[model samples]
Target: MLAPSQAHILVIDDTPEAIRPLLLALRGRHWRVSVATDARQGQQRAQLLAPDLILLDVRMPGMDGFALCRLLQASPRTRDIPVLFLTSAGAADERLEGLSQGGVDYIMKTCEPAELLARVQIHLQLARRRAAAVDDTPAPPLSPDEVVLRAAMRLIGQQLAELPPLEAIAARVGTHDKKLSAIFRRHLGMTVFAWVREERLRRGRELLADPLLSMQEIAGSVGFRSACNFTTAFRERMGVTPSQYRKGLQDGAAGKGTPAG
Candidate 1:
């Protein structure tokens, strides 16, 4: 497990106010956090600090989130750092775009503070687990299949936000749709569409934990066409409505509060 104090977070966003609340929220959780206002600076900081995780904004004046994600993934020095997209665009297409660009996750600006913290914790946990596995390997070699899978996964993650038809992805991979689907099922243990939905929900859950974003914003950010649809899907996957889930988390936190006396 990654200790809260040892966990380093790099937050990339252009808005100063947006950065403040996020920093404050993470600080409250005892996380060591770094802030960067643009992709260029963020990249530089990432090289220097090698943060455990990166929270990148989707839209910017130049060199947007997608470009930055590709750059990071291409660099041998920084490819291992997990990236999560923080953006105002929540359309299915937009979410898919972020994922396909090599981001580990996506988050809407309308997320609750607490929910945001929980996601940070979860990703950090995953990163630590992955790091442990790497440490155990003396000189692990990448297989050709892994290379292909990584490429395909990157494409899938980036394009999901657009909700591209299955055929398009298959075409990009130079394979038939049915064949690609079978490959996904064999390797990832799920259909391509199912993987897309799962990725969307995973991002949605992270957004739901943040108090800063509204339910509607979260809905849009995670690719649901409307709040109603988002809520329904969320309920289906999580066994609770978005509002209810947030309430439950709040209630749990309250229950764990130290006594005032």
Candidate 2:
């Protein structure tokens, strides 16, 4: 049996073609792996399996990546799991959006497989260290910056589905809207709206992986009012519609034969 500290990772992506190499690479390293194609199921798996880490894709049909990240961060059961976003969006602005949405790190889809694996290892190590510190320092308080960031992250994560306007988030964080925008730009390197859109796309991808939910239902659950709107946004960010993404996931699963339950 693999050691627990070897770390189990759940890869959540609507693009099965992109995920295949990542799955093979992590398994080769002797890390147990679980795959979820959509955000809702991914969230369910994270709660049930409590994987040590989550490898998340930023775009999908329904909830998108950022929304899923927020849900994970808000839920006590899964909040501590480290999330690393795997995305095709490699611009500096996109990277900042991913980080601001609660990702520990972001990996571009164009990254070499070896580099991706190395980054995963680094994130797992850091996660373990942070967990240890929390265990050892039971009474320690967060620094001012840490406190502010955590609070902001928590609110953002919870609201990713409903996604409040920038002014609302700024008010909650006890800052002027302009100051909040500047803070996100300065520290996270992206505008607040861009970060929110990235996160929504992330959660939508996760939701698209579920077979039980209809496209319309998934869209509504993830804050989209209509399937047309969801599909358009998904394609804009991910370069495919929800139906195509779902088909790819099904095809990949069929090719893999039976997966471990």
Candidate 3:
């Protein structure tokens, strides 16, 4: 149980100077605040600080807020922390996208300080209440295989655009390729490369579901080197090209109902 004054907040933004007032306002409540300027640093800081709440910027170099949010959700250590998205863009699609990506709130960067602080306070209080409601008993520890899988998946997710070799990935997770292969085979029912292919297609499908994204942008985002390659692979896997699938999605949405993502 933490006191109100003991609550910690992490602010992940590329331009900290732009959000100086928000930082001051947060500290005014006597809460601990930490800042990270980019997605990688933000991830490291979140894991280290285990902050009660996270204020994430929508745009950043390397990885965007959505990607970082997904990474956090995939990790056991930091998944439960509430994330509030701060963006200069107030477009309906952007707000909907943020919420769909598991954000608790999508706040405009230009919002009044008082309103922002009020929202922050609400989430903080809710977090405390949820924590109190959880059982005190500790959950069972993860096995070695589970730990490796999580770490490997996290690494792969972060570097999807330029994934390292299998041996390198295995080494990073403190295991050799053979053991890592066995672990993936046993738990995921596939080889590491096979899983990577499936993950790329999965993420690509997700990007395709968004009507606002272009084919080239979607291709690059999910680690495909070129739109042509993405199309080829997508066609091979889904029995249709990315364009066809997206058209089907839009047509379905227009005719009947919301398409399943």
Best by TM-score: 3
Score candidate 2 by lDDT: 0.76
Candidate 3 lDDT over residue span 59-130, tens digit each: 787767876776566566676789999878678998886787678999988988888899988898888888
lDDT, candidate 2, at 196:
68
Candidate 3, 117: how far from true, in Å? 0.9
What local distance difference test score does each model get? 0.76, 0.76, 0.83
Model 2 lDDT tens row, 83-165: 99988867788787678867999987778779988998887888787787675332343333333355465677667657778
Report the lDDT tens digits of candidate 1 across residue range 143-252: 32343355556666655456668776665443457876877887889988888888878888888778899988877776778889988988998999989998887887
1 or 2, which is superior by TM-score?
2
Highest lDDT: which candidate? 3
How do these models rank on TM-score, best leading? 3, 2, 1
- Single out the weakest 10-residue window by summed lDDT for candidate 2: 137-146
Off-target runs (Cα >4 Å) in candidate 2 are 1-5, 136-261
Query: Candidate 3: worst 10 consecutive residues by lDDT?
Result: 136-145
